[model samples]
Target: MRREIGKRILINSPENENAIEVHNLHKSFRLPTERSWGLKQAIFNRLRGIKGYKDQKVLKGLNFTVKQGEFLGIVGRNGSGKSTLLKILAGIYYPEKDSTIIVNGNLVPFIELGVGFNPELTGRENVYLNGALLGFSNKEMDEMYDDIWKFAELEKFQDQKLKNYSSGMLVRLAFSIAIRAKGDILVLDEVLAVGDAAFQQKCNNYFASLKEKKQTIILVTHSMENVRRFCDRAIMIEDGKIAAEGDPSEVAEKYMSLFK
Candidate 1:
């Protein structure tokens, strides 16, 4: 069966305009009910009239709008579809038909950290590679190379291969590079607190600066403290639908109540 995909439009607009507008957004995936051990087994199952898959809905008829320079937080439990919604907004997935998503201004998404890193490559080489993926020219990377390393506190590891780095180091390096990308809308997922306590302090300072500058950000996290601290508004998703929205404090309260 052919699935109809809805429209995702990008445009540049004035500061007063909404940065993102999502209407009737929905998404689903076809999950295999039975695993085919081999090609012959798959053919036999098909011949036996077994579809072997079921449709699983992740988001259902959601509607929301984010204004320019607003910091928005999305809170939900695991499997509640927060990441799926961010992926759809980042253009990595398509929504169902009749759903419309309109985005104004340039968007930078950090859905997965270190996505473009090569394990065999040196840190310096990986920096260039990741920069290229983010649309940065070699000259721009060169200008920021020292700053990036300084910020990540991995200046001595520049010549080391990425495979040798610890998980915390990798997250720090990726996050340092990601923040350098300039965009009107920033989409982040579970990246607020990374590395050791000192590193987390740095992240807090950086986010504080962004808040002070009125940067537009969409953050998906389970941290209600972060929601209250950084978000101008917040939304809570439950079972593929928006269960609560509005002021950050109210949404955070509603989210915490779900566990009780």
Candidate 2:
């Protein structure tokens, strides 16, 4: 059923057990007008009454639904609004008029590297901070603290500032925390692998476990292999709208055919 809230619409999923539902979603970004990068030029532009920005629509009218425990893959070329859609689903961005979004469960998103970590803080401190963001109490984090550090292989560096860690180390720690931060729906973007080959294998196994358990996951990635390997369904986005959606292999093939 679809209802309206002002200009926006609320689309309830047809599947009573859906994990996500979206209807006529739209998003746009306002970019500051480019001018000479100095206070003098800034003052000049303002004095002349030049419009200070332009709007770029990143997502057009889009609609979709994800059933409970579904592993859904999203794919698109660069600048196709795949990331924007993910952020909307994650509640980091709101849609334009008449756009609808619904999430039926606790959602945990690992959409970007270092999404919830403070660079100036020690790894240990950042862990607690991120845990809190995921709604874990300090006591609950303490119970799982050792496991998180151990998985990231940064037990010795937990006291070190995150800014000092290498890119690989940072992702490792972030990935470790995301896995431990359990939620009913998991949203990930281009994070299929991390660390060395051994760790990559571990990640594969972890995905397998999740698949077996029927965990609800939404992934955005360029890796067709991962999409085919893990996702039971997939969607291709083009120009901020869904171009195709259905079986994982079929959607992946359609995405590849665009190159041909």
Candidate 3:
């Protein structure tokens, strides 16, 4: 079965008021059916009139809009399509036919934070590598190099190989670099917490600053506290559909009621 892909366009017009707009969005994945592993099994299943795969709908007919500088939070239970929706907005996945997504300006997806990091490289070397991936020139990276290490609190380990750093240290470094990204919209997926308690507090404060500055952000998080604290508006997805939307507190309460 062939799946049709929808359109996603990016336009950088200052006159455009919305940072993101989605309409009738849908996404589905074909999962192999039981006992349909290899070519032989697939041919046998086809001969037996078995489709050999099941369609799993992750998002269905979602409609929403995010105004410029609005902080929108998406919340849902496991497998409820929150990540799928974010991936679509981030251009990592295409939506079904008839679905439409419009991004008004450059979008930086935090989901791609550690994409270009090389474990064999030193922390400083990896920083430059990752910065290049984020569109920073060598001189630009040098200008902010010290600040990046200071924020990640990994200055002492600058010359240390990334392979030698702890898991938490890697996350901190990636996160520090990611925040320096310049874009009109930021899409984040559960990346608010990194490192120890003190570091988390620092991250929290940084988010607060972004919020104070009215930066456009699309956050997908399981933390209700974060939703209430940072989100100007929120949406909760349930079973591949929008279950609730509007005020952050109200949506958070609706999301919490799911367990009850």
Candidate 4:
């Protein structure tokens, strides 16, 4: 089934080629037993001989195309599958059932803080580790090491164990490493929310520079202000589907309306 979906994606390619194309994407996860009403219900289901539980569909038939050098922002409330969509695009998770994801160029995803870090390792060791995870060689990390540290502002704590570092510090280091990797597609998921206000401003400026350099970025953020400032176009996902897609300002306004 996955092979057939891949074939369909290949056949639907645009003539000009896009940075990323998704067709009929769907993702779901099995609900845990604890999520059910109680142990009695779990026992009842077990006694009923139900082995496979119903899964919660996180994404449903989502389709979108991102052009080269486009800055796209994905906005949604909690559990609206915004992060799932970005993860699918980043090749972190394969969609369930019939779905297609075609992406061109290298992808750098900063989806979660401390995602690739080792708590037992020193910050310096983790720097090289994370760099390698991002497809950077030792020589490349050696060349970019100082710059990464400077950007992360963790020079003094470089030798400290990552477990000893604060969450903000971890995020700063991860963000610095990700941005320095210089991938063609950057998937940022609420990364700017981790650090201090001043650092957030710096990160914003860095994104601005990336935009000027024509890097394709897909940002999943709940911050409407950031969406309005950084993205040329924005999309809102509701119930695992595209609710709106258009100008950043207009889409953001409409997204906020749902809360009201």
Candidate 5:
């Protein structure tokens, strides 16, 4: 699918120019209904021509391409499939047949904070575990351990079990690890701030630094302010389809119009 992104022609852009591309993407979920629970009930429902489940269509055929060094924001309201779409791009979920997702570089997605975190493990142990999940060797994790500890400001709490840490403490540790384990393309699902006021400020600054580095980013967020402030382009999704796309400011304005 070809579309004009500002003055550039997306389809004609060189492969190296695009950090990511998605085409003809579709997704749906089969939600269980009453008769789906019991074997006998399911059989009876099937006999009566009932599928015993409701198909929840989440994403329609979506198409877009993210150029290298572009900070693209994905904006949507609740239940609009924003997170679902991100997961599909992160390879956590798959779309239907004929869907195409192409990535030009290594992708690191911070879609869920601390997805593999173990509450029973000590803060230090969890760091290694999470790093391994990110495909880092223990040796590599060891090399970066001190910096992670220092960035999180949880050096003193390293010995403590994660369950004992405050919510803010957990966010600090997780966010610290995510940024340290960098990749060619970064996908963030939220505002990247969920802790104390000071730490939130640090998070903002970190994002600013990333912007200065010309990092390619795909951010899925509800914050229009961030869309306008950080994104060169933004796309708004509604009912599992692209509702609007292009300049972040214009997209943000279209998104706001729905509520007015």
Candidate 6:
């Protein structure tokens, strides 16, 4: 009887549940021209023309699913909604119309580098600020502070104001802190291009470690090499919609073909 029940369960098994599910997602932006402060200019411009302002459709009915432990790369040209999609997934932007984004895990987004950092604040202060934004308590940040500073190699300049630091330094500090914040899902834009070669190598090593741990990663980049090396699967977005989705190499090839 047990064997028969097991067989029946196997037969009725459902498809694997995905870690991230996006169904019919849509987003748009309205570019409205404000009325001029001067009444004469506003009246003149309105009388002359301006029939209808156009709304830009940034994302249109996008649908895809990402499974646990999958490294998914998004490849697209500029203005193709790559950043927008990442933002939506990161909960930074709401879709314009009817849409659903179901994410079933902790998420860490390395989208805006040094965004929460205040120029007047010291590096140490900024570190705490960014940590809090990432949902790390002060005690947790204190526990990881030494490691973060070591990885960022900014111990010497920790007391220095952020405005005094170079762009490379800022990127290093921000990237290090963001990566150390634990999350089941990691989202990265093209921020890897900001650092020098040595730092880039370190980032690659870090990503390799994450891959070994089977962390789910969604990376948006134009570098085909990164897509081929880091991603198990790739998706190409064209004109706010999915154009192709499959093996990283194959999708990359198809994406490149569009330019030719």
| Among all candidates shown, the one with the greatest lDDT | 1
Q: Which residue pairs collide in model 1, if any?
A: none
Q: Per-residue CA lDDT of candidate 1, range 1-260, in tens?
A: 57799999998977547999999999999887776666776787789987677889999989999999899999999999999999999999988899999999999998987788999999999999999988799999999999999999999999999999999999999989988989999999999868999999999999999999999999999999999999999999999999999999999999999899
lDDT per residue, candidate 6, 125-236, as tens digits?
Answer: 9999999988899999999999988998888999999999998999999988888778878899987686998999999998899899999899999999999998999999
- For model 2, residues 1-260, the per-residue Cα lDDT tens digits are 13233132234453568888887888888687775566776678779987566779899888899888899999999999999988888877767768878787778887775667888999998998888877789999999999998988889998999899998888888778778868788998888767888778877888889989999999999999999999989999999889999999999999999889
Query: What's the lDDT for residue 255 in model 5?
Result: 94
Off by over 4 Å in 6: 1-16, 34-53
Q: Which parts of model 3 are misplaced by more than 4 Å?
A: 34-50
TM-score between model 6 and native: 0.86
Sliding window of 10 residues with minimal summed lDDT for model 2: 1-10
* lDDT, model 1: 0.93
TM-score for all predictions?
A: 0.95, 0.86, 0.93, 0.86, 0.90, 0.86
* Per-structure clash totals for the candidates: 0, 0, 0, 0, 0, 0
Query: Which residue runs does candidate 4 get wrong by more than 4 Å?
Result: 1-15, 34-49
Would you list the clashing residue pairs of candidate 4? none
lDDT of 2: 0.84
Per-residue lDDT tens digits for candidate 4, residues 135-160, read 89999999999999999898999999
**lDDT scores for all predictions?**
0.93, 0.84, 0.91, 0.83, 0.85, 0.84
Looking at model 6, the pairs that clash are none
Give me the displacement of residue 159 in model 5, in angstroms.
0.7
> Candidate 6: global Cα-lDDT?
0.84
Model 3, position 149: C-alpha lDDT score: 94
